[model samples]
Target: MDLHKLYHVHDFHSRNFLDTYFSSKPDTPFSHETLMYPMEKFHNAFSTGDIKGEVLIDISLGPIIHHLYSAQEYFRDIILLKPTDHCIIEVKKWINSRTGAFDWSHASTFVTEMAGKSDQCEEKEIGLRSAITHVVKYDPNQENVTAPIELPQADCLVLWGVLDVISKDLDDFVGNFRRFSKLLKPGRCLMYYGALNGSFFVVGGERFHIVKYNESNLRSILSDEGYVIRHLEVSQRIIESDLIDFDSVLFCTAYKEQKI
Candidate 1:
């Protein structure tokens, strides 16, 4: 319900979103294991024998490209959609290769490292920049999130923390994802990442609320949305630290089942 609190410039740090989440700093809650889990699962699902296609649509990208490092290897075009101007501008800076763009270089190395590939951070940056052809502002309040701007149905949908955190309730969560699934081509794949049993997190010393959903609710919603689970994993917190307050994280790779 409180979507606007931590996203404002004063609360959110667009500059450090990547480094902050995927940190080498001492006792970063997003440990090497936490960061590596999704990447490894993605590598198995997609990098190994997963489907490939042209467009990858991302909503509420926040400021991290960590999820898309290996994905850029397969997707010819990546579209970054943001809910706010600040998020859009920050992502555009990196897309345009500006001088002070947030460094996503670490994402490339870490993603490739997870896949047992040699260091290719520079190549990874080039790949992402070249693949991401559009950085557009999306209005979620509209009947269609991409309204006033027509976008092709994507081959794959990438959602990280958007559906779970933005919706005010379970019904809102269901409706939001339903809209998102419409943007995906039928039978195409969807990759999702989000907090499990999390309601709020600290950013800039302020508390931000997130929708709390469990495994059963998530499965029911996905099934209602016509997704057939190809892979699913839940990683519980191995240790307690700081910055994040979620008990677990959900990683899912599924395909949109075609209507009969």
Candidate 2:
């Protein structure tokens, strides 16, 4: 990974994602209708009791604010686990409402609309801010990813957009899944989201690696590890030269009977 081209999630959002894939205008001006589909599915899952959880632990989240609108309402405490110092600092700055935090007002508004609310965008932000109870450093390389902090197993483990960038191969994916599984109590929920068929993405004019995989690989690995997929949703991105390099997005809700 070229250090210069690589950046945190917030940086990626500001640089390439915001206008190219998730533009404010999803109609005649631009098309981001595909990106919004997963958020809506997640929103509906949280709203309709499709995903049940008390404590939700987010693994390797690098300052992502796009999908938490409904998750904040569902989980009492959203613990964001950072795998690096830079990501940790960046996340805290936004969580603490420090200066120049990345703007997520548009995302908040979109989520609010998905939840059938016509207003109260500020309240939604406040609600999310309040729900974020802890920010802890996690080491993805370790067998126990969230080491040094002996936390009780969480009700749910959420892995989103991290596996592709972090995992080098199929084995790495399985290893990380096991590490995350250790954080979830037996029979607990697992919510996963990821970009499909993505090999690399540019951030701030720098390119970073993404381990491309198809639906078969994802479902096979998850099933092998004992997760029962209850709900699954996939969105195919419309191919465009200016748009981000991802073929599709996968969102799923599953539960583990026993960890492998």
List candidate 1 stretches off by more than 4 Å: 1-11, 32-34
What are the TM-scores, per candidate, against the unseen true structure?
0.90, 0.85
lDDT of each: 0.75, 0.71
TM-score of 2: 0.85
lDDT of model 2 at position 77: 79
Q: Which pairs clash (backbone N, Cα, C closer than 3 Å) in model 2? A: 5-206
Question: The CA-based lDDT of model 2 is what?
Answer: 0.71
lDDT of 2 at 176: 75
Worst 10 residues of 2 by lDDT: 2-11
The number of the candidate with the highest lDDT is 1
Q: Weakest 10 consecutive residues, lDDT, candidate 1?
A: 2-11
Q: Which parts of model 2 have CA positions greater than 4 angstroms off?
A: 1-35, 242-244, 258-260
Could you give candidate 1's per-residue lDDT for residues 1-260 as a string of tens digits? 45534342233665656555666565666754346676666666677746688899877437666677777778888988787776777888888889888765655677767666656667877887888888877766677787889999999998888876567778988888887888899999988888888776666566666778988889888898888998788888776766666788888888999989
Candidate topping TM-score: 1
